[model samples]
Target: MPTHHIVSAFDEELKYLANRIAAMGGHAERMVDQAVFALVNSDHGLARQVVANDEFLDIGQREIDEKAIVIIARRQPMADDLREIIGAIRISGDLERVGDLGKNIAKRVVAVTEARQPVRLFRGIESLAELALTQLKDVLDTYASRSIDRIGFVRDRDDQIDAMYTSLFRELLTYMMEDPRNITACTHLLFCAKNIERIGDHATNIAETVYYIVTGAQMPAERPKEDKSHKVTAQATAAADPS
Candidate 1:
């Protein structure tokens, strides 16, 4: 093949690899949403389906890796092209981790199904799942569009997931303290929320990777600051504080 043809083929491979990554992300998002839906609705069938679908995510990760290796070996891309190839590898790994997290959440759903009585409603889990889903979608969008602005939004949304996780932990701790009977169910709920929150973090990691690929610069470690405009005053206490 001519040199021009080889470069064109290499570029095409990179494009296809990116599409595969997006497909992987889409599957991961579905896994998470299905896991949460199962937990909240106590749908045994959905939980089982999520467990079975995990294999697809694994297959996707493998495909992306295989294609990347083929490109590296055949094209021998250098510099920025090499970085793009490596970045796809890293992104696929993160997507696999997110898939694992979803599977973990599904396992927790199975545990919840086994436990009879003392099953508290999983409000915290629902909130965390929603936040994670939003972040996951946003990150995938950044990847598709190569938009730096969306990356910042994805990172900012992570704070909401973390706060929900913290709140869930505190609530579960209270449950465990109040009634020893609550310990088993609460512990499982805690683990489920933790898994979902970790998934959100992984999504943020992807967003950071996207930013790096676009600008060749790492995103800062900065976090969103708390809004403190609603300080309670002794005189005429405010009815509420809106974030």
Candidate 2:
């Protein structure tokens, strides 16, 4: 019947949209990995590649937005169908932000490479990157599979990434305080660490999107935050006080 054919076509469009989102997620993940690798290895070439690849992510986001709008206009989807299209748009936006964060890291990598830095500092950054990358990969997989059960696991991991970043911030501050020459390198590394932390945040946002797509309900509340960088800054200020 005509209705059956229309339903089939709508399903196909949804599938295509889902596939595009998955592809975007993969690119975002790879960019994060490469940006961190460049930072750890001082590979300016790899950093440049990450910066260049951001254009593709931008294009991907635009394409997804276009497709979502067209589908909504033509299909007039309701409830779950509407959720699916909306989720794609939201996820693509988050992935675009992920790309931008990776680009920020790449920019920092270029700066750090120009200045000499200690190897141990890189080790801390690399460890945080690994955890953040894992979160991103797992959340993308959850989105593709529509696995609501796995969403909680991905959401919980953001705190760990924040904790790691806070620790790195403190350590970098100490390094700068101990050696005047280390200020430039440590400042750049601090920014890179913050970018990685933000990527974890975007991954968490994607996880929430997955939950909404599956259940058609908002997440219960905001996830608990563990970032303590502000506290560390306050401690530093107190220590510097002459009074």
Candidate 3:
């Protein structure tokens, strides 16, 4: 099929937008990592730095959004070009939200540190965050390649992130119930867990955008029931474990 010049130009713009969004995703992921690092190590300076870097992420998101708008207005793209432009706009919005969520987590880190209190951030939350980051990267790769297979891969990983969230939440609830003194700290930790959960959701949203761009069909939320069952079982196990 011969490529139309308009499609070609739109492709260039969309590619630029994709690259920009991926850059934003990368930065947001780093921000989350730094925030957690700050929490685990009580590094208030690093938490502040993460919060500061979020401003740059905002600028990056705005630039991508403006470019997407320009492409839509000037190019008058249709079909796939249209999908690509719209997807860029939506994905960038999600990425911006991810940055905001990271900032929120960083703010919590500062509060926890200033109180001279320690929150036991276990392997479960760390594992979940890492899983979400992997899914974010996979979504970016699939967006760049427009590969349906890669999109599927991201979907599968999203399930894993969800499971991690379920386990983390259950464990935190146990801590709160065990000690009244743990209430305030556990609440903050819950918010942090929710922030990480939102990041996973945004990554899933980006994957859906890629799917729509490639197929022009909205991907249905099809999380497996088996996964949910397994997550429930694990939560029960965590509740029962005395260690």
Candidate 4:
């Protein structure tokens, strides 16, 4: 009887951790959306609000960590319980980083506003955010449901986000090269785009953690990576231009 009671208490503790993680996930997703919206619309007020709201995620993480440590010390969980606690810590950390990424984008709103950029660039950035935020929301749903069916699709979509980011990277470089005056705006947009791409990355990391939580195995080490921005160099572009 006492053993069953202890197990019940442990389960309750795990549930608490899961609930905290879900709250953090939802808050982080909203932050990403608002940050992108602020950047695209040049809404300085909304951007400032996002920068201020990051404290919620930080506080949530600290709370989860503190609870997990107490549970670990008291319960000595094994197998799935251990995975759940560990995964909660990891997921919370990723969500916190997502919040930071969102904050980073918000911080750049003012910088990107210094030079006048075309609407197309902002649209391009918005499209990338849409995809990334979709990935994030889907993965969070998968985590909540523990549905294996949704996991693969979420993981696979990371490549799509990477490809889109690469396309944007190329287009931004072209604009900067075409007009030196656009450099300031395009450069800030580039960093913002990178932050959106990283939000996709954190979503992918959460997908892997979800997989681990549901299954005991780690995901395959080699996931497909399509971001080729590093190879886009002046010399490389010139060499490829066989005029």
- Measured by lDDT, the strongest candidate is 4
Per-residue C-alpha lDDT of model 4 across residues 5-61, encoded as one tens digit per residue? 345877778888998998999899999999999998888999999999999999999
Error of 3 at 195 (Å): 0.6
Ranking 1 against 2 by lDDT, winner: 2
lDDT of 2 by residue, 2-64 (tens): 123356888888888898888888899999999999988989999999999999889999998
lDDT of each: 0.77, 0.86, 0.75, 0.88
Badly placed stretches (over 4 Å) of model 1 are 1-6, 115-120, 223-243
Decide which is better by lDDT, 3 or 4. 4
Which pairs clash inside model 2? none
TM-score of 4: 0.92
lDDT of 1 by residue, 19-116 (tens): 88988988999999998888887788888899888888899899989999999898888766776778788899999998888888887776776755
Model 4 regions more than 4 Å off: 1-7, 235-243
What value of lDDT does candidate 3 attain over all alpha carbons? 0.75
* TM-scores of all candidate predictions against the true structure: 0.85, 0.93, 0.83, 0.92
Error of 3 at 53 (Å): 1.0
What's the residue-level lDDT of 194 in candidate 1? 74
Looking at model 1, residue 50 earns an lDDT score of 92
lDDT of candidate 3 over 33-67, digit per residue (tens): 88877776778889889999999788987898789
Compared with the true structure, model 1 gives a TM-score of 0.85
RMSD, one per candidate, in order: 7.2, 3.7, 5.0, 4.0
